[model samples]
Target: MRVFRIAKKQYLEDLSGEGSRLFGGRWNKKGMPMLYFSDSLSTSLLEVLVHLDFKHLTKDFGYIEIDIPDNLIDTKLKLKDLDDNWRDNPPKSITTNLGTAFLKANKKLALKVPCAILPMASNILINPKHKDFTKLKVIKVADLDIDSRLIVDTK
Candidate 1:
């Protein structure tokens, strides 16, 4: 499988599970570096966050890993009423739709890609498995193939 990467500033949305204080304080408003597999950052993933948990990479697994969900979203809506619903019960999940990607807690069952969270510093400074994965390679909606398949090592 190909590993796509992003910067802490490139993350499309706020992270869930992490409380507002922790995420807001730790992460900048732009978001953090992340990796995932999908057709376009806009649609969905074959895998979503389920079993894997993230922690300091070196101490935990040396590499935080996430799977690319194969779920393909059908229709997308940004109804004003949807936001209005927030008055009574806004989605508890952190839903985000950045120009580069979309992330949400309550995303439709088949509408999210499994993603692995890692340190932006490590991705930039450390030795990535692939020599070709340049410091310039940051995950974006355009980077993913239209089919949602990650470009893996040709080897």
Candidate 2:
């Protein structure tokens, strides 16, 4: 299977997930840094839409697709299925071995290839620390890869 990731121009070629790791995100507050991917181009757009500042969006942005290894262990869950307790009481941090048991499990699975193939809205968290993560490859989007005319402001 394949997954897509939409990002700012600077990160278009980045596979290290360094930015995510350094800054941390909703899933990993302590900066574990997971390479996030979406199931499709449209989904990838929606994933980053929430983070866009229209003023700054004028800058270059692009999408890339990656092939998922068959051997990797990827866990998927519906957003609604996530436990309420998890929402109310999130982990102190998703650093080595800390956080809700389920989330921790997901983290462990992610650490394997360091990837969790979740729904596009949820994000495919990739752990760069995993040994096999290097196997993942990406195809950068070219001019013909996307139709700029089709894009529209969600607002």
Candidate 3:
């Protein structure tokens, strides 16, 4: 299975999950290393765009395509499996706790979860500590050109 991650150009080559670990995210708490990937390029873009602003708009950005063996992703968490407020903006503990547990368990390299921005779409969470994490393959990485319309002059 192929997954996509959008990030700054310089960090595109760094798959260490260090950024996510230090800052945490909707799924993982601070200090937990986890890589977030979207099923499609468009979704990846959207995921990054939400966290970006005009200042970040001018910076170099890129996207990465990673290939993961289908069998490695044996676990999935559907929308129905989550609480009604799972999509809350601040991200409730229910969601983070669930993800934290998954990472601690280290039972699977990848977990299929619903995207909060677009529930119809899905995001893949990767546990860098997983034993089979090395099985993930980085197939492609290239510059991402964000639409000018998406940027606004704050000044």
Best by lDDT: 3
Clashing residue pairs in all predictions, respectively, total 15, 4, 0
lDDT of every model, 2 decimals: 0.25, 0.54, 0.87
Model 3, 35-64: lDDT tens digits are 999999999988887877666766588889
Better of 2 and 3 by lDDT: 3
TM-score for predicted model 1 compared with the true structure: 0.20
The TM-score of predicted model 2 comes to 0.65
Sorted by lDDT (best first), the order is 3, 2, 1
After superposition, which runs of candidate 1 have C-alpha atoms over 4 Å from their true positions?
Answer: 1-16, 19-21, 25-61, 72-105, 109-155
Superior candidate under lDDT, 1 versus 3: 3
All candidates in order of TM-score, best leading:
3, 2, 1
Residues 1-155, candidate 2: write the lDDT tens digits: 57778777767778776786686655564555566676567666655665665444444776778776745645544545444343332322332233223234543434221212223234455666666676776655632134445456665
Off by over 4 Å in 3: 153-155
Can you give the TM-score per candidate against the true fold?
0.20, 0.65, 0.92
Candidates 1 and 2: which is better by lDDT? 2
